[model samples]
Target chain A: PSSGIEKPTVKRFESYKRDSQLPQAIGELRILVDYRAQSIILPIFGRPVPFHISTLKNASKNDEGNFVYLRLNFVSPGQIGGKKDELPFEDPNAQFIRSFTFRSSNNSRMSQVFKDIQDMKKAATKRETERKEFAD
Target chain B: MAAKTVQYDNIYLNLSEKPGKLRIAPSGLGWKSPSLAEPFTLPISEIRRFCWSRFARGYELKIILKSKDPVSLDGFSQEDLDDLINVIKQNFDMGIEQKEFSIKGWNWGEANFLGSELVFDVNSRPAFEIPISAVTNTNLSGKNEVALEFSTTDDKQIPSAQVDELVEMRLYVPGTTAKEDAADGEE
Candidate 1:
C-alpha cells in the first residue's frame, strides 16, 4: 500500500546570520516585513523577534473600533483540516510558537503588512510547487 | 573624586515610546524623558547584574535589580559597549555579561525557566525571553498546547496607544510521562 510519491523534506531557512544585519526600521517598534531577508520582524516587549517566511502559515488583519489587529499563524501539529505530513517541522516535539496576535492603531500600515505577508506566502508556495514539480 | 557620569542619548527605557537621556554614575542610573514629567532612577545598591545584548533597535543594557522587574535601555550603538562596560565596572564594581541572541529564526526551541524568565533557546542560543511576571493568564487550549496572555493594561512604562503590542502567545509543549510521574511521587 505504498504510494510512489515521496514526502517533501523540510527545508531550513534563516532570517539573519548576525544581529547587525537586522533592518534598521525595527527600531520603530512596529512590524516590519523584510522581503530580502524573507522574514517578518515583530517587536515583542521591545525586542525585535524574527519569524522566517517558511514558518508562517497565514496572516490576517482586521479592524476593531480604533485599532487594527494582525494575527500570524504558524505551522504546528494537531491542526484540524490540513494534511499532517504536508507541513513538516524541524522538530515536531520541540516547543513551537503557534501564533502571535499584535494590535496597532496604524490601520493603513497594518493593511499593507497583511498584503505583504500574503504576497510572500503566495510566492513561497509557488516556488515550493515548482520545486516539487521539478523533483518529480 | 566622584565617578564621572556617563550619558547616552536617544535611549529607550522600558520600551518607552520616546527616546530619553540615560546617565550612569556612581550614584546609579537615571533616565530622563521629555515625554514624562518624572525621571526614573535606579540606585547602585539595587543593582543585581547587567546584561548586554544586541537587540532590534541597537545595543541593549539590561539591568537586573534586587527585587524589582529588570530595566532595559535600548538604542546604544556598538561603540558604546566599551564605555558602558568601563563605567559600570569602575563605578558599580560589576561586570556586564554579553549575551548573544540567535538569529536563525526557528520557531522550535527548548523553553527553559531561568529564574524569573522563560527563555526560549534555539541551537543553544537564546531566541527570546519572557518574564514570568508579565504573563497574566495561562490555559491549556488543546492537547500539548498552552496559551499565555500578557498584561497590556498595567504597564506604565510603554504607552499602549502608541505602539503595536503583543497580546498573547501560544506554545506547544510535548508531554513527558516520566517527569510527571517523578513529580507526582515526590509530592
Candidate 2:
C-alpha cells in the first residue's frame, strides 16, 4: 500500500477542452473533492470570486499506501467579517468552516468516496460564470 | 457571494511566541488540507499581521482573527472549547462519510505530531500562549507552507497569520490557445 494517494497528474486547469475560453489574468479556480479517487466539482456557492483551493508543491503518501499527504494553499475569498465569539479563536467565521478534505494517498485503501477529481476543474469554471453576476 | 466554509485536521495554540492565541487548520501534509469545498485555502491575501518566534522550547505561532460581525468565534470558554472540539470531530466524521472533505466548505484538524503546548488565551486577550516545549527553528513568511508531517506542538518553524485571504477563484480556464497546447502535448 505504499502507493497511498494516487500520483497526481499535472495539477493544471480542469480540462481546457471543456472550457477553452479562460483568460490568464485569472478568473476562477477548480476544486477537486477527491476522497480516494471519488471526486466532485463544487461551484463556488458565494461571492464574485468563488473561494478557491488548490494543491501547492506536492502530495506525498505513506509507505503503507494507506495515507496520502499534500500541501495545499487556500485563498480566503472575501474581506474580514464578524466579531469575536467566546471561543479560543475570536473570529466566529474562523472555526465555522463548511467544507474541506482529509486526504490520504493510501493505495491499500480502495474505492474513494468523492465523485471524481476530473470534476474539480468544472467547479472552477462554474464559479467564473456565477461571479459575473453574484457576490456574497 | 455565498457563505464560505473550510476544514482543518488540527486546532492548536502558540504558547512561546505570540503569548495567547490559537489557530485551526488541517493535519494533512501540505496546505491543501485546510481548503474548503469549492475548496477555500488559508491564503494570506487579506492578512496584514503574522509572526513565528523562538522561545524556551519549540516556537510560537500568532495570527489575529478578523472581527467584522458583532459576534466572533475566537477564544471559547472551557465548555465552548470542549463543544468546539466535539463539533470539529463530528465534522471530521461527517466529512469522511460524505467524502467531500467538507459538506458545507469547512474542515477541521487536531494537533497530532506529538509534543505538547499549553494554550493561555482567554476571551479577548491580545497575547495568547501555548505549551510548545520542543527546541526548534522559528521563522515567518507568507509564501512558505507549514511542514508536511504530523506536526506536534513542538516541531513548528513557519510564519503564522492573523489571517490570510487567498483569492476565491484562481481563474482555471486556460488561455485561448490551451487546446492547441494540449493537442500538441498529446501528439
Candidate 3:
C-alpha cells in the first residue's frame, strides 16, 4: 500500500549577515519593509529585529479609535487551517513567534506597510509555485 | 578644580518622544530637554548598576537605580563607549556591563522570565526583551500556546510617531504537560 504523502523539505532564508548591514532607517524605530533584503525590520524595545519574508504567514491592518494597528502572523506549528504541505520549518518542535502586533497613529503608513508585506508574500509564493512546477 | 562633566547631545531619556542633552559629572547624571522646564537628575549615590548595549538609535546606556525603575538613555554612538566608560569609572566608581545582542533573524527562541522582563534569547544571546509591567493581558490561546497583549497607550510619554509600539505577542511553548490531575488517579 502506497501512502501518497511526501516529506516536506526545509526552507532556509537569511535576512542579514551583519548588524551593520541593516538599513539606516531602522534608527527611526519604525517597522521598515526592506524590499532589497526581502525582510521586514521591526523595532523591538530598542533593537531592530528582522523577519525574513519566507517566515511570514500574513499581515493585516485595521483602524481603531485614534490609532491603527498592524499585525504580522508568522508560520508556526499547530496551525489548523493551512495546507499540510505548507509547513515550512526545519524543526516543528522548535519554539516559534506566532504573531506580533504594532500600533501607530500613522494610519496611512501602516496601511502601506501592510500592503507591502502582502505583495512580498504573494511574490514569494508565486516564485515558489513556479519553482515547483518547473521541477515537476 | 572644577568637576569634569561629560556632556552628550541628542540623547533620548527613557525613549522619550524628543531627544535631549545628557551630562554626567561626579555629582550625578542630568538630562535636559528643550520642552522641559527643569532637568531630570539622578545622584551618583542612587545609581546601582548601568549597562551599555547597541540600540536602534545607535547605543543605549541603561542606568539601574537604587529605588526606582531603570532608566534608558539612547543615542550614543559606538565611539562614545570609551569616554562614557572612563567617565563612569572616574565619577561614579561603577563599571558598565556591555550587553551583546543576537542579530540572527530567527523567530524561534527560549522565552525566559527574568525579574520584571521577559527575555527572548536565541542561541543563548538575547534577541529582545519585553517589560513584564507593560503586558496588560495574557491568555492561553491554545494547547501549549500563550498570547500576551500589551498596553499601547502612551503612558510612558513616548510619542506614538517616534516608535512603533508593540501591542501584542503570541508564543508557542512545546512540552507543556496537560493538567494531569485527573490522570493521577488512574496512574
Candidate 4:
C-alpha cells in the first residue's frame, strides 16, 4: 500500500496490442431477387468499409439448400468503400446489387442469434473431445 | 371477390428498445425521419431509402393479424386494426402519426420504397403502422411477396427480457402493390 504503483486491472480507452488472432465480429448479409436474377450483398462494419455484391448465379425464389456467404473484416466507419476485398458478382445486370426489397435473413435479433451459434460450436467441440478420449 | 388469404414469409422481433442500441438490425427504423418522405416521392430516380436500408438488416418488425380458422382464431377484427393503430400512435411522435402513407407513390411525400416505420411506445409497446407502397418493382421471393413489421421500443432495457418484448406486433403486406398496380392504370 505504501508503494505509489497501481494495479493494472482497469480497462477501457486504453489497451496494448499483441499477436492476437481472435475471431472477427460478423455483420449482416443482404439477399435480393430480381424477376429472373438474384443478387447478394455484404455490408461490413470495421476498419476498411467494404461493400461487395454477387454475380447473379442461376438463382430463383424456390431454390432451396443454397447459401450466400460473406466475411467482413477491416471496416472503418464514416468512410465510404474503405480498403477491402470481395467475392465476384454472379449477377450481370447489377453494377452491384444497389438496393432492393430485402429478402429474409436469419439475423433478426443479432445478440442471441449469434450467441446460439457460438454455443452450438462449443457443444460440438466438447463432443469431439469426448469422442477422442473414448477412442484413446 | 373474396379477400384472398396471405401467408407471411418472415416473422421476427426487433429489440431496439434496449438502452443504447438505437437502431434495430434488418428494419432500421431511424434511418431517416418522417419529413424526408417529401424527397422520396415519384418519378423514381434510384434515391436513398428512408429507413429500410441495409444498415438495418436482420431486424424483423411486424404486426400480423391472422386467422387460420376464422371461427376459432383471433380473426382480423376491427378492434385488432384499431388496436394496432393505437399502438402506432403512442410509439412514434405526432410527426409520425400524421405522416400520411398511401398505396401509391404518385403524390408528394408518397413512398418509393418497400418498408414501414414501426413506431413503438416508450413502454416497449408497438403502436404504429407506416405502410410502404413503393415495393412493387422489387422481386422479393417467398410467401410474403411484400414485407412489413411491428416494433415496441423503450428508452431503457428490461433486464432478463427477450427480443420479443421489443417487437410487440406484426403484419405482412403481401403482393400489396399487385392490387395497387391494377388501380394505378385508372383514376
| TM-scores, one per candidate | 0.90, 0.22, 0.87, 0.17
DockQ of each: 0.67, 0.02, 0.63, 0.02
lDDT of 3 by residue, B76-178 (tens): 9999999888888888778999998776667887787654567788768888877666788988889878898987646544443355888899988777742
Best-to-worst order by DockQ is 1, 3, 2, 4
Prediction RMSDs, each to the true structure: 4.4, 22.9, 6.2, 23.3
Write down the lDDT of every candidate, Cα atoms only: 0.81, 0.25, 0.80, 0.22
Candidate ordering by lDDT (highest first): 1, 3, 2, 4
Higher-ranked by DockQ: 3 or 4: 3
Clashes of 4: 38
**Residue-wise C-alpha lDDT for candidate 2, range B63-170, written one tens digit per residue:** 322321011121222233343334334422211011001221222211222113212121221111222322132222122212111122223342222111111111
Pairs of colliding residues, candidate 3: none
Q: Report the C-alpha lDDT of model 3 over A1-136, residue by residue, as the tens digit.
A: 3357755667777788777888999888899999888999988765688888888888888899989988898888887676767847676666789999998888888888888899989999999899877855
Model 4, range A73-136, lDDT digits (tens) per residue? 2111112453233222122111121211112223433333334334433454476467546744
Compose the digit string of candidate 2's lDDT tens values, residues A1-136: 2366544232222212211122221112123343322223232211011122332111222233544322233322221332132112223232112222233343333123222332453464466457534732
Give the clash count for each candidate: 0, 115, 0, 38
Docking class of 2: incorrect
Best candidate (score: lDDT): 1
